[model samples]
Target: MPRRVAMILALLLCSGCSSELRNIELQRVAKDWSLVIRASQIIPVYPLTEDLQPGDTFLVQRPIDKQHELYDERGFLPLENLIHRVNPRGYQAFYENSLGLGGDAQPIPKRWLTNQQPWTQAPIASFPTYSFSVRSGSGFSLALPVQGVPIGLSLLGSDAAQGTITIADARTYGVDTVSLAKDVEDWAAQQRGFLRNYASTGAHPNYLRVVSRVYLAGRLNVSLQSSDSSGATASGGAPKPVELVTTAGGPGPQDASLEAYKSNLAKLNELIEKSLEKTPTGSGQALLPGGTVKVVAASARAISLVETFSRPLVVGYLGFDMLIGPGGTLGPPIPTYAVLTAQLEPHPATVALELLDTAGLRHTYEVLTKLGRRGDTRAADLVKQLDGLGTLVPRQYPCNMFHFGDAAGPLSIQHPAGTALPDQKGFVRITLYLGKLQSSIDDLERAQADKSLKIATFDTRDAAVDAYLAGELAASRTALRDMYRSLQAHGDLLAQAQEHATQATRKLLLE
Candidate 1:
């Protein structure tokens, strides 16, 4: 038998026990349901920024009057300028210095450095913001500037393609040495590695954290597009390409050594690669880059990139922000997790009424019997009138049922059994039930003044309400039934009270 049924049977068999014992048993059963309901409602918390120090526990509390929707925002830093093209002589010097092997690598003069710059800086200021919309299981367009060059973009949810990154515009701006398409694909793969590591070592396994990190990290220069267009674009005309310049003086022992520059460049590349590899990928197949970059005029620098995810996101906001470190280098990207609560339509009034009836029926019956035993006919009739009030009240259930976003699993139990009304209505019903029950108990107290009797009655009602709020309708229902059975077992006490009242009536008649 289910534990619920077993507990019911045990309570019925022990009906002859004192009311105190029955209340204790009912509380025990109510606790079991409370645990389950509480577990389902718990939402895990995550760090919003990478700079969170140890021993800090962030907890978000709900409003006392109303509920608010949750929004999650994560920021992704851009890649720092690192890779630079070099001639055979410059390459040899960089290679030897990087490996720490002593060799006479001739340093290219500062005059040559100005003309032979490897990477051209794209004017990022031209496009300050890109407006885009992403629907669940749909694709959207994105336009962003990389190294100051504008690149057009498109994105598809996981429903379309899995783990694929396709680049549309691939023009070489400066010396045209690095493959932008190949680098993007490699970067996607590295991001997938980061996700895998987080899943393995994160304090808690959160799907939102994994999905958001990968999606934000894969695309560079992402930012939430604003609905309004004001201030969206920079005031200046198209930004001109800027050349990479080193501040080091002319070539000499006093000048900045080529060996030192190469070593620093290698370190920057290593750090960038490490950051890329640790970022997570979108849900779907692993991302593979295979598209070609279209080299067009510098004026027509539009690259349309398409990325497909595994699942659709109802993204209220999607975009990236730049965090520039010292020397204009991008800082490390941090993971962010968002918790959303969806508003659901109210359930039928019958659902809540059914729960109230199931949990309150026994209590109702007990109150009626006690009133009858105490010879309080008026109180008994008033208590009986409450039975029809359910019909007079509105049938709409009021509590707002909530669930997490698509990343998390669906809500545990939409509506628990026993007419689980929303919080407000449930509390109202509990108050009415307690009021009527207390009226009968008060009359009994005036007649006999038994403290134990009042304690037993209050204890049972309190336990039932506690169970109901926790979504343990069945337990609350059973608790009420136990209270009824305890009252029925008090037949001898009721008989004595009735006889006393009858004798008093006879004495009044004789007078």
Candidate 2:
């Protein structure tokens, strides 16, 4: 295994540093997805450039607001720059390396190194401002240079195939080649390892961490060109020569389209309320009110009712397993599973305002539910403001339905047996009958086919005599051999499968 890993690494290195690399150009791929890169150093200035204060909060990627969107002018830092690329381990190393300047280096503030913040709160910036004076230092200033040497390569592809890299300027008291090389090499190794693993798993190798998709494809060109302005474009315009190996994976979609699912989920909320308050027909499972319900259908018809009717029903959770036949026929409709575990309840704070005003209670509940369901905390203040209006108003209602996402697996249950709704009974019975008959027919067909083959084969002792018996003898011997081999193979496979099952069971039990 070690040898194989080494061989793989060697091959990767060869490809990474081949003579073909000289022509490879530094290119930037445009993507809707964001990329983050982190920095390896922070140099302090005698006086801060923008604002030099004692303690002013600075963060990247503040909490998302109610609309499932970032607050205005606020965004998660793109993975494009070094500051966003560095990981925690990298940060620790950078800090330690920077501090290694001994007595010559200024000490970093302790608070900046701590992870003491809420999950929703952003990480504190490496650089912060203080409003007041310090004991020895009245004010200190620092600025991230707009021109600093880039220590990393950006993978690019296709039409956006070529681009240039430039250094961002900042104070350089803390910059060192050794420190930068170590950080950049470590980051490059990480990216390469990840790409290799992704390739081995049949995934697109160019998919960056967090982006979950490839921004570029094929070979890239890298070169160096100088801009007319020496100070502004000296290091950059001339693209540094480098090579990158990218891989592609099978086209796979996101786990689920959250946006599309959310709309249908909202409609189901009303249906859930209606079902909970009343009794269902036969199954006695509390079903949402005023929607057409039907039994499992055989084949494609089953897939349809599930995909279509699911929108009207407000079960806490639902899974629509669609089976398409040879030519896209919907097969074997199964409700799989549907249940109402938690409904989105109105925030008491938001509802309280409605009681005081009465006119907007319904609208307030609706809006608050929408905001809460999307992980938007921006609504918190609005909800709190409403609650403060009066003590007489109710503060909570059933609106935040978290159970919808929490449900696991397909909802597999066929219930409310027999007939209940007389008006709809005939059609329900017919659909049920067809489904049952189709399933039965398929089963019978399989059994008959099995029996037919069994009868056609039997043990034959004769060889030349078996040759005289010819085709029948050959078939008999072949069947027996196949059966014996199958039994032996099954035992080995079963043993291996049992071992895996045992380990999984232990993990679950221990956890």
lDDT per residue (tens digit) for residues 183-215 in model 1: 222232223333333221112221211111111
Q: Which candidate has the highest TM-score of all?
A: 1
The TM-scores, one per candidate, come to: 0.20, 0.15
Give the poorly placed runs of model 2, Cα more than 4 Å off: 1-217, 222-425, 441-511
What are the lDDT scores of the predictions, listed in order?
0.27, 0.23
- Provide C-alpha RMSD values for all models, in order: 32.3, 36.4
The residue ranges of model 1 lying beyond 4 angstroms of the native Cα positions read: 1-66, 69-303, 310-359, 372-378, 382-511
Per-residue lDDT tens digits for candidate 2, residues 286-368, read 43322222111111111111111111111111111112111111111122111001122111122111121112232343454
RMSD of 2: 36.4
- Candidate 2 at residue 473, lDDT? 26
Local error of candidate 2 at 191, Å?
37
Q: Candidate 1, overall lDDT?
A: 0.27
